[model samples]
Target: MPDAASNDYSMLRDAVVFLLAAIVVVPLFRHFRVNSIVGYIVAGIVIGPHGLALIRDVEGTHRLAEFGIVFMLFTIGLELSFERLKTMARYVFGLGLAQVVVTGAVLASGALIFGAGWGQAAVIGGALALSSTAFVLQLLSERGELSSHFGRVVLSVLLLQDLAVVPGLAVVTALGSEPEALAWALIVAGLKAIAALGLLLAVGRLVLRPLYRMIAETRSPELFAAATLLVVLATAWGTAAAGLSMALGAFLAGLMLAGTEYRHQIEADIRPARGLLLGLFFMSIGMLLDLATIIPQLPAIIAAVALLISSKALIAAALGWCFRLPLPVAVNAGLHLAQGGEFAFVLFSLAMGAAVLPMEMGQFLLAVVAISMTLTPLLALAGRKVQARLEQRAAGGLEALMTETEGYSDHVVIAGFGRVGRTVAQMLDARDVQWIAIDLDAKNIAQARSRGLQVFFGDAAQDAITAAAGLDRARAAVITLDNPAAAASALRNIKKKLPDIPVIVRARDASNMGELMRGGATSVMPETIESSLLLGGAVLRSLGQAESEIDEVIEFFRRDAVEGGQRAADDEQ
Candidate 1:
């Protein structure tokens, strides 16, 4: 066995090698039109087990990578507050449910083809169903898609996966050498996990926010960091005590703190730690790229990548379609989600430890998962290209909306150009109303403009964004990102800065309506009410109620607006 002093020395040496390789190789990937993530993986191989064999602290390195995931979850939790999740109910619930069912089914079938037992197949399928939250979120963020319709769908599906992965981890853990007892343990563990999540949400709403506010008031970054760390550690400990993964507990802790005031600051402070650990993680994975193993396993590994991507992509596409997304969106979400991910390694490890899978299968799974991780970004780039091409072909019809409407000042401003909001803008347009559309969704802005509409790209929640959208010059502002929490926050900011700006906010359902009203929205409306009304109006017109009836209703609403009655805004968000 290696001496303790020698082990420490070797670990330090590996760190230098990993950093040096990352610095040199990252640039090369950019030059070659490859993703930075791909570069990191390649660099991992070069300085890891495959090339120089310079990294020796394999276990220690991965433990650090684990922190990369922890910080990452904290950031995700901060971003995805309950209010944000509310508006994304359709995608989160609809698309998310579909992705889990469909993808899990497909992967399980493939495992069955390999003659695995039902329990093993369940483990494989469920594990395969989880896309890499870390990788996909980072990619979309860099490409700026975390807020688009498709991005919303991806986000929803990812959230579901996060919730689902906990059970998956339990499932793998339960299938120990004594399968029957393990199965019962797994069932008990899952129930406990669900209870923990409920407790997290409850405690967060009741206690975490106040605690964080108290910390924030002190203006101590160190104290804030310590509190965050405490939350994660405590929650993680609680979860393990109940027989779940510590990661799951950490994630719940993040979810609890998501509603806190210091979420953004906490994320900022912890990000540096995440960044460093992420590098070390990639380095550790690189060490696994042993040339000796890979050379013999290349064919099988490449085949696994193809199989995993193709299979998972098809399942994801079906789920997207089931969620009623546009065809292009469905296809792209599928492709983007096709890869095997880091969790595959986790599941495989558990499987190996339990002797459910041979050591050979675990090694093979590692190689295949690594390859799929490398391909994920490439798949995303491909999806972007495909989406662009589809948009270009569809641009002819979009041009009609871009015909340059003049006299936009002192008019209404719509912040998001998504389909629902765009429809509202169009209805107002047919009446020759003056309004300028603002959106952070570049795709939506581009599409809107291609059709002859006057839409600008912007984040309307920011003072800078509203200023760019001519908020002060505009008579009214419509908050329409479909995210209730963000919408409420934006409404608050607008009220503070320009108290007289009449703001109409949208909601997914009644539960969201009150929050916006409390936040100072002039009116709040749900999608269903408006859609039903439009259909009712068309039927009335067909029955010969006369165009005057529609005109009269509009006039009445305008009159009601003076006294602030129930005219309900568009709920497109």
Candidate 2:
């Protein structure tokens, strides 16, 4: 009984320490525009056993933190549907397959040259050949580049790497088995994995939508959230039970729900939990680093880290270029994915436990991987700078060529394609007005493209996406993003990029209209005011008033609303 109480107390203390570390470290890192992931890792190191010893239960912490990855994968799945995946099939299978194979072979050869046996070399190569999906995705999302052409290629590669984990683990298991039984072990693992995948797909397609619909009909937010959690955990457990990664299961569950109407709500509900747990996951990784052991071999570790990053980066870039990606985009993707991934730790740990790899070598490799991960944000920043330079130097290069092929000129660029934006687009279409739309919702983009609308999937706040949309050649721009903060940000970005271009923005209410105008919107239409005016017009018409009189009354109210918003802006100024 006493031991149980002590364990509970220890867990509570550790949680407090973790939160404190994040509270202090994350904001500091964000203030400098650094990736919050780096901050989380640094926080982990500070409070970990190697640092202040604020948390001694490393394994327990790791178990809890792993859900972060599961949740992250689920959210990523929500962003993609089967149709989009089918479209990306070539990159996923071709570029992704080539990347893993070539990168693994090169690393394995190097390992062999360094005196490691075939089994150990294979493990090392397979593990290091993959890149950290969590780190790369978070970075891309932060920079608003996840929907860019470069980001799409990178995401395709990451998806393949996630799938490759099953085979990688199978190889590790086979290596641990007796010589005569190795082939059998691999075959069994493969069959089990396929069966698990098939079961997940079958169950998800049939069960998830109905489950969500039933829960949503209750109009209970709590029940809906609980249902979301259940689906994520159940699917994750299913895959892990079959000797597959839990994250993969969660991703599959999300993919199933991607086509459903509840996707956006589920994503919103899971976001907070995902961020918190994912940060904890990074902290757990930091706890794994033993500075005392690493200091003695600092120089060698640094050398290995450099080699691992450089080799992976160059190999990825070469393959991407060969696969017909532009030099800049390919190089950027390579640098973003150059670091050793989280799976490396899993593979190395398994190998060490199975007595297939020496503890000393595994520890050394883990340290190298950790250091490389810590350097990823910096590496990605370097890639962006390099890409900018290359793009500048090649003015009429691939980017310009692609833009020319799209043939955008004197068109209205719509920053959002929600209901309001769609209505505006339709009205423009009726008059044959040339226009293009950009949105972050992959599902929405897929549906729009199917109907032959010139809508693209990307963040309008990103200069690269805006440039690709031919913002320079656009006669006007419209900002109708549903989120107020997102709408304001889009307005500011457009005004900054092209101050001379007329920009129309939609506001949620009159209170938001002044803020949008202050952000340099040429005109702001508050939805609430417009709806109220229309309703008032209807009421007057029902009272048998003349149609002309009702129109005049509504116009008077509209002018008053605009004047009121302008007055508010003037008062604030």
> Judged by lDDT, which candidate is best?
2
Q: What is the C-alpha local distance difference test score of candidate 1?
A: 0.72
Which candidate tops TM-score? 2
Model 1: worst 10 consecutive residues (lDDT sum): 396-405
Q: How many pairs collide in each candidate, listed in order?
A: 15, 0
Q: Write the per-residue lDDT of candidate 2 for residues 102-191, one digit (tens) a residue.
A: 999999999999999999999999999999988888887766566556777898998889888888888888788877777777778789
lDDT of each: 0.72, 0.87
Give the lowest summed-lDDT range of ten residues in model 2: 392-401
